[model samples]
Target: MKAGVFYGTNFRIGQSSGGLPIIDNDDIPIALVQGNRDGVANPANAQETYAGIQDPPKAFITIPGANHYGITNEDNLIREPNRPTLEQDVAIETIARWSALFLRGTALKDKGAFDYVFNSGDALDPNVSVESVTKPIPEYTSVVSLLGLGVIGASSLLTNMQKLVKKST
Candidate 1:
């Protein structure tokens, strides 16, 4: 099985002539797993990306009181006082449950299991309310992946041509 995880906020697109485009869309799947308190990939940015996707079977799992690096559960030698212990087990369990349902077509519906990690409001600031969820429009296609390959191919060809021209000179 193939699985991919992306942890970032900004996404940019370029024009066909290799110039950055102004009318770029921040399309993303609804099946994203994110941290509500993520500093790098903020929830607002994730929401913006979600707004641009035109597909279904999507979900955005937001973990509370979690940061970008904190989710991975790396070792902390200094042991800063009052630091909340990383809920590594919860993270692992959430990813596993969702992945099984999404990637493996698991039949068992465990709303409690998924909601525990995603719907909990405890991790967010008291001033923040759960953002209203929306489904992606069902008409959009993701050409970014194919376009990326094309860009790489064209770049390689250009480099080869430049080398040949230099050799002739």
Candidate 2:
């Protein structure tokens, strides 16, 4: 029995390369655990990946109210102390339960573990006041031009540095 866990924010490799690697048919009984509220690796990407897999025993568990960093017990422990601690025990228990049901050929439903996060209700309290929601057209255009110029400047600098190193060598 083999099992694989993939979080919604675990799209670093996926986004860097445009999309995630396709799952081979040989790799069966895979489990993908995603977060519904994830900003980085959106649920759509996970769904796409799940759809690409040709395996039969695949399960996609979308945890509601979880953000990019909220799914991990370590992240929750440090960032949110006031909330109930999402200890390692809970994570291990969830993983074990999922694995036993999915990979062990047990007669469990396709719906994987859907544990409610403790600090889901806590809203972010920013110290600074927010300005206008919309930016001026001219300002936005200027910002884009400045960013383009910065990129060009950085590229020129890198080219010059490489030339200098080559000359020295």
Candidate 3:
């Protein structure tokens, strides 16, 4: 599971200082689901990112008591007791439901799904726990993982290059 981040609001594809690309289709909505319990992707990060977008398809969703990867299932989550508790299943359901609404504009069939997703709780609640919910993923693993990634990245690049060569030929 990879967490992708594009820091700073100014996303420029061209030479000019363009703010952001206009969304042509509403179906391909841009959204961000931030975990209030996560310090890494904090409320500030969400606010800044939301501010950067030129036009928003939907309001950013803030899941109460979720960590950085709150969108994923409970098995993938690490627990921190001091924080506002979130059920693992609820976290998964919330993300799944929220994503469905944004990317497909399709609402979750479950009765309370839409209402649950729309409940954007307090982003800057000072009372929430600041203790680390999860440890550093790479740090816990062997350095060999880094080498494995390099190999994978290189192979991926090569595969793409081969595809481009075939297309040109």
Pairs of residues at least 3 apart in sequence or in different chains that clash in candidate 2 = none
lDDT scores for all predictions?
A: 0.46, 0.49, 0.47
List of clashing residue pairs for candidate 3:
none
Model 3 lDDT per residue over 46-130, tens place: 5555555443234465666766555554433244333436765677676565555443332223434323333322223322211
lDDT of 2: 0.49
- In model 3, the Cα lDDT at residue 63 comes to 67
Residues forming the 10-long window of minimal summed lDDT in candidate 3: 127-136
Candidate 3: which stretches are off by over 4 Å?
1-28, 75-84, 106-169
Residue 14 lDDT (model 2): 41
With candidate 2 superimposed using the best TM-score fit, by how many Å does residue 112's alpha carbon deviate from the native?
13
Error of 2 at 17 (Å): 8.3
Please identify model 2 stretches exceeding 4 Å from their true place: 9-21, 74-100, 106-169
Candidate 2 accuracy as TM-score: 0.42
lDDT by residue (33-140, candidate 1, tens digit) is 555655555566666664544443344555554445444555233532223233656654544554454333212335553343235632532322233233433443
